[model samples]
Structure formats: C-alpha cells, structure tokens
Target: MTATTAAPAWRPAAPVPCAAPLPAVDRLRVAPRADGWTVTARVAVDPRDPNLAGHFPGQPIYPGVFVVETLCQAMAQAVPGTPRLRAVTSIRFLAALLGGDEMELTLDVDPAAPAAGAASPTEPGWTVRGTGRRHDGTVTAQLRAVFDAGAGA
Candidate 1:
C-alpha cells in the first residue's frame, strides 16, 4: 500500500524534518536548484531525528527508504514543489546511511527537464537524479526522483 501525506494550509515556524529515513517526509534545506545551480550541499545524519527507533535499535542505520528520502529532500528546491513531495522513481539505496555520518548530497538535474515543461510550470516537475556520497566518494545511495509541483494538488 502507498501512503500519502497531506498538510493543512498553514506553514510552520521551523521546517519539519523528514520523519522516517525514507517513506517520505518534509525535509530539504533549500527550495529549488536554479538553472546553473552546481553547488553541492552537506547533510548530516541525525540520531535524534526520531527515525532511529524502529529502523533498528542497536544498529540504527538510515534505512534505504530514508536514503532515497534524503535525496528527495536535497533536490526538492529545484522541483517547484516547495513544502511538498512529488514522487520518487527507481529509488534505491546502494549502501547504508548511518547516524552521525556526515553525508554529501549531490544532485544532477537533467537540463533536458525544464523549469516549466510543455505540460506544467509553477509545478515545474524535475527529472532529478541524486546520489549520497561519503567523503571518499563512496556512493551510499542512488535515487531517481520525478517531481511535479502539482503532485500535491
């Protein structure tokens, strides 16, 4: 079964963190990636993030779902779906994202994918692909996310 999360019309003070490591949540720092936004951002794994409880007690590694979610969060700004989550396709976690491990999120937005497609604009969906890498370039996770702003609508 697929789960859908809906938020009321009011915005909150602090941004809500992604609840589970995966399975969807409200996270991501920036809004969207600009045309030439080539900068890479660092994301830290938090043990206090509440996702650890059920993930595994003694070994609370960030689940593959959340690893996909992390990529989702990192690329959200570029998707035109502020405070919203679209969809993730071909999402997979190659390795485990562990708590306390500093994570580097790198996303390469397909230039072929537009800010506004022939179909939608404000909901400029993005054909986004992201990978979570450790300092050594070890790929922990790889994600293929297709985001449409209207997805929430």
Candidate 2:
C-alpha cells in the first residue's frame, strides 16, 4: 500500500512533544532515488495556530518541537505504513519560523539501513535527514530521525 492509501491507519505511537496542533502539510512530494527516497513538504503558517500563542506571547516564533513534528508527519505521508519514530538523532534551529511564514521541508531517507547499534544486525530501520527553509531561502531548521524498519511493509 502506498502512503496515500495507508494514511488512515498511520498514527504516531510515540508521544509527540508538540504543544499545539500539528501543522497541516499543504503539499507533499516524493521521488524514489537509487539510495532511497527524497520527500518534500510545504507547511503554511497559520497566524492563529495555537502554537503561536504563549510561545512568546508577543513574538511568536514557531516552536522547534512543532518543526520536528511536521518533519515526522511528512515522512509518514511520503512512504507506506506508519513510521514508528525510534529516535530524533539530531535537531537544530538555525533561524526562527514565525507566524505566517511558510516553510518547506525536504528529507532524504535511507529505508534499508539497519538500526545503528541494534542488538540484532538484521533489525530493519530508516535514517532520515532533512531541512526546513522559508520560501525566500532562509534555512530555519535541520533534523535527523530514526524509524523502525517495518514501514512500507
């Protein structure tokens, strides 16, 4: 089943730390590559999104946690099956994404990798590295996450 068809069954088993409702992915694009896949998503910042409130009160910059959630959601929609988030290996906020500032997330996923240092060498896993940037070219965030190998099954 492709991601689109499996959407209803996919849910995050891990507790997402996002303080507000997950951002809606306005657009999703996926391309199969020799190594794995390339996934991109567009997120529109809603000025009234609850995430903006209290995040700063006066200066609402989109929370970094929400950015991570957006990335995870995008990956789930880009591939089949729900990706059980195993670990967020890395996350960095180079710039702030403020209310009404749209951003695009791009991910390069390696789906056939074994879990790094897994107890069993055959344990399946995926490594995703990606970035979020504004339309004007301001790179706002960069992140990496690991997921169980059972996805796309």
Candidate 3:
C-alpha cells in the first residue's frame, strides 16, 4: 500500500504584546439587505500602535492580519448571537495599509450559504465576504471568511 501524508494544520504567528490597545473600529453601521446584510465600518490607525514599531522601523505598514481581524469583528457585531471565525477561505492584499491611515471596511454576509462545522440551518452562522478600502476608494484587501454559529457562546 502507498503511504499517505496530510498537510500540517495552519496556525497564526505567536501574539506580540502591544504597549497599547490596537486600533479599533471608529464607526460601524449595519443595514439589512434583501440578499443578506451589509456592514460598514471605519478604523483609524494609530501611529503609536505597538505593532507599528517593530513592523518596520522607518516605514510602518499596518499588518494585513489586522485588516482581516477588523472584518471579522464587523461580522460578529452585525450578526446576531455569538459568531466565531471558523476559517479564512481566501484573502488578497493589494495595497499596503499604513499606520495613521483611515480605512473603510465593508462586509456582506450570506446566511444561506453552507455553514462550517456541524452547525444546523437554525443556527447562527454565515459566510462573509468583504473589502477594505482607503479613503480615496483604493482597494486594500479582499477577504472571504466562514463563521460558525454559537461557537463563541
């Protein structure tokens, strides 16, 4: 019989403690749509964010992971019940998110899509797709994520 190998599980880098709390969504608005729901959020990057310090000494660029976290936060807030991020299906970063930059994040959630894990239709789960854009409308990133229902509860 031929041997089989399984790919290693994916894991994020170890957390780096920050001197201060990381940036947060300044404003968030949620509106229901016929298709699903729409979430608009704004985040103001702080120059003093500890992540900016060692990220680059001279040139501090916002970490891409932070952008993803921002979108996940928006999804959790917009959706009812406790939602937990199951996986990031895809994400593309087109432009560098710089420190002190103001970013506009938009998320669209589709509850009809298949849920991850063993959650049922009656559960509170969704598939989320979103984009992060600069004030001038430059697309910084596009992401798709799956959230499990009541996982955080």
Name the top lDDT candidate.
2
TM-score of 1: 0.60
- Per-residue accuracy of model 3 over 108-135 as CA lDDT, tens digit each: 8777454454335445567778889998
Residue-by-residue lDDT tens digits, candidate 1, 1-153: 111533223221234344533423232333223462331446566666677766778666766666555555554443443434455666666677777776666666643354534334344555666767766678877766665543345
- Show the colliding residue pairs in model 1: 21-66, 22-65, 22-66, 31-77, 32-77, 32-78, 33-78
lDDT of 2 at 150: 54
- lDDT, residue 37, candidate 1: 31
Overall lDDT per candidate, in order of appearance: 0.53, 0.72, 0.69
For residue 60, what is the lDDT in candidate 1? 65
The runs of at least 3 residues in candidate 2 whose Cα sits more than 4 Å from the true structure, single-residue gaps closed, are: 1-20, 115-121, 150-153
TM for candidate 2 is: 0.77
lDDT per residue for candidate 2 within 9-123, as digits (tens), equals 2232333334427645767777775577777778877767766777878777778888877877776667666676777888999998888898888888886455465334366
